[model samples]
Target: MNESTELGEDFKCKLPNVSMSTQSKTMPMIDLKVYIRVVAAVFSISSATALVMALLRLLTPNLFYVEPLDGSNIVLHYFITGLMVVTSAIGLLNSCVVMNRSAAKNTGRNITTWLLLDSLFETTRVVYVFICEVVIKGRGSLQTYEMLISIAQYLLDSFLYCQMILRH
Candidate 1:
């Protein structure tokens, strides 16, 4: 019996990092949930800020465009900015869902879905802004700074989501 006790101790000690036995008593369930929440929170806040910027551009049309060159651009801007507002609001709600510890277990799928949707929005918005920056404003428009920021944010978020997806 003494030898058996020693063997059991050795087994526990040799267990891998994710051993439920090891982490269960220590942290319970804060590990994955907290990290996921943090990521989602960042995504939410950034999306909100994007929403604001889009709204401002929509409100001040001439401020974004030097001249009223075409009707198609005005419509496209209106449509894309509206999408940004809706998607960002959903993204913010998703963050709140992940932040609540008692909400649900096995939320990996749901969170992944949200992240995928956010990724799509982020990528598409950056592309749309870039095309407008180059074609409409010669790449040095008033929205240039916002466009650059969006590009950087999208790249970072894409990398993080990719890593998280791979882990799960």
Candidate 2:
């Protein structure tokens, strides 16, 4: 037999009665769907956690030791928290659709980038709050305790962003 005939026979034996063309088309879709579902679940959990934290802060403003409860603070808190949740949800949904169609090469990258950006924004906001609470409007110059806490938060944010970049 010729080389092509031998190769064909080997392929058929390995695959048994399965059609190569159908397997090629269906397996990828199945894998893509699974990947999308996993990604969505992860982002959904993160968003929910942030929402819960925001709710806690809103309800128990005194627990934060930041400032008096006011309208502007409430509005800004809700807005930022809501934006985080919404953006994460949208990214997950977009990823699902793209992966479902097996055309998410760039979409996945964009989602990752967006998530990183959101994390960075949160970090900045937290830092600003820390500075305001500990330095400018704070009592006296600065409390060592408050400074340590702010520094810790900043470190945590940096670590999170680094992880995100590495994952991408």
Candidate 3:
């Protein structure tokens, strides 16, 4: 019995020391700055694409046109397209600021504030478009694709902004 006890003690002594603190903890896969920069780049590309689509719809209606509900009133269609262009420009500008800050090594509350404002504006713009085209005018089918894309963008931007704020 003593020999067995001695053998058990020797076995215990040979084992590596491990504790709760020593164990690897789950950590973020990427650095916060890198994440911000990547997300900002994505936002920039999306904004640029939206801008191009809006411009195309505006300038070359024959090639890329999502016809408005009131076909007779071209003015409203132009106005909505103009709004999209302006909103996309704002989004692009905000993203550029975020991306530039990563290079400058400047992470400030002001940038996060700008991000919040941009997200709010983007959500508002999407909501307005939904109300105007789908609800009021009853023209949802014509621009379903654009509307869905815009809604998805809004959700993604909101989620990314929240994550950025939390990380910051």
Candidate 4:
């Protein structure tokens, strides 16, 4: 009877090794959900910052004195702000889908690619703004400083993205 009991204990221990294979099936889903949440948070914070910058420009006209707020500029301002809000909301929804396991691995990969692309575009936009302020507008306003700060932020974001990609 003691020999049988010992054998049963050994079998139970080995049973866990058999169950380990099933755990891998759910691990990717959990990892995808976490990645999506992290990306969504990044987008949310970025959108909030953009909104704040837009509002500051609207309230303090002297900060960017070169271009007067004409009809076209006002429209552009609102459009950009709307874009930020929309992107953040879309990211949040994507994260929800990932969390629900409705999003495939390919979909998660695509989202990650899009995020990196967006970061690149943002970097380009900052560089363009900085160039415009310094070369076209003679670098006389707070916009130049803001552009420099934005460039630094974009660099930091790129660094973080690289780290994430490498870690994954």
Candidate 5:
């Protein structure tokens, strides 16, 4: 055998050098739809929990020994909290829609507006709650820990929705 043949045989066990093809950097599965769906699920759950807690407090006012709060203020509180509940429900539905679309491998752009609106609505609710909680004078017992938690859920949902717009 020639010197070249012997050299090739000596390196027969080595693999041939194959250059990697250039692949366009695209968003991974977990980055966009998957990530937002997961966040949406958690956001939905948090909203539901906060809703239940707020309802419990509202129904059982005597449990906390809350003094008689202003009727108008109570009405406003219920209105905002109820709006939050509806917002959370919508978020949950949006997540389900996203999951279905993802399973079909065809996520659409329709949800972008909904997500943006949810973020705005939730932010408004959270801000209202924060302002009320700070400005209100004497309904300390009614505004229990659950109120803060409920507000937190709204905040989290708002943040998630805002983030989802970018991903969507």
Candidate 6:
């Protein structure tokens, strides 16, 4: 009877170990690099969209006229879109630097600095667009859609900027 009891205790210990191993195997995994890549993809897409807008405005001005800058000429729109493309490209490059596992500490600091500048510029642009297009001129302009999209992009960039700073 004592030998049977000892056998049962050994079986119980083996069962728990098997269960623990299975639990660990079944656990969900999270990869931070994937998120960083996702942000980079978003930046790329934003840059592409801005580039397309710039091209459409340049090639076919009648089809893509901005209401706010209606009297000012399409040059302003082109300039704004160009700025977006440049900043988004910078953001993508910064994200790549961040994803490098062997990147030096100074490289990380540089990435953070670039992200900070991008975030600040985006924030200012959003506020300026909101105030100029929505507040002073009213929301009747067709550029409101563009303004909202830019605002969303700004928010996403700001989130990524915060993440980069926190991680580094």
| lDDT (Cα, 0-100) at 58 in candidate 5 | 56
Instruction: Give candidate 4 regions above 4 Å deviation.
Output: 1-36, 58-61, 66-108, 136-145
lDDT of 3 by residue, 83-166 (tens): 888888888888888788744554676666667757755764675466445544534343556567767777787787777777
Candidate 6 residue runs with Cα over 4 Å from true position: 1-32, 64-75, 92-107, 120-142
Whole-model Cα lDDT of every candidate shown, in order: 0.69, 0.49, 0.68, 0.54, 0.59, 0.54
Q: Best candidate, TM-score-wise? A: 1
lDDT of 1 by residue, 1-168 (tens): 999999898888554677445655674454665667777777777777777777777677666676774777667777776777677667666666666645365276776677777777676677657656765662336576777777777777777688567545
TM-score of 2: 0.35
User: On a 0 to 100 scale, what is the lDDT of residue 86 in model 4?
Assistant: 51
How does candidate 6 score on lDDT?
Answer: 0.54
Encode model 2's per-residue lDDT on 24-73: one tens digit a residue: 56644444335444544444444444444445444554555445535665
Residue pairs clashing in model 4 are: none
| lDDT of predicted model 3 | 0.68
**Runs in model 1 lying further than 4 Å from the true structure:** 1-30, 101-103, 138-141
Which candidate would rank higher by lDDT, 1 or 6? 1
Ranking by TM-score: 1, 3, 5, 6, 4, 2
lDDT of 4 by residue, 1-168 (tens): 999999898887443446545756764544644665565456445444544554565566456656665675556544544454455345345434434553455364766665665564465445445443554442337676666666665666566567456445
Pairs in clash, predicted candidate 2:
none
In candidate 3, stretches whose alpha carbon ends up further than 4 angstroms from where it belongs are: 1-27, 60-73, 102-105, 135-142
How displaced is residue 23 in candidate 4, in Å? 27
Worst 10-residue lDDT window for candidate 5 reads 20-29
> Candidate 2: which stretches are off by over 4 Å?
1-47, 66-109, 128-164
How far out, in Å, is residue 157 in model 6?
2.6
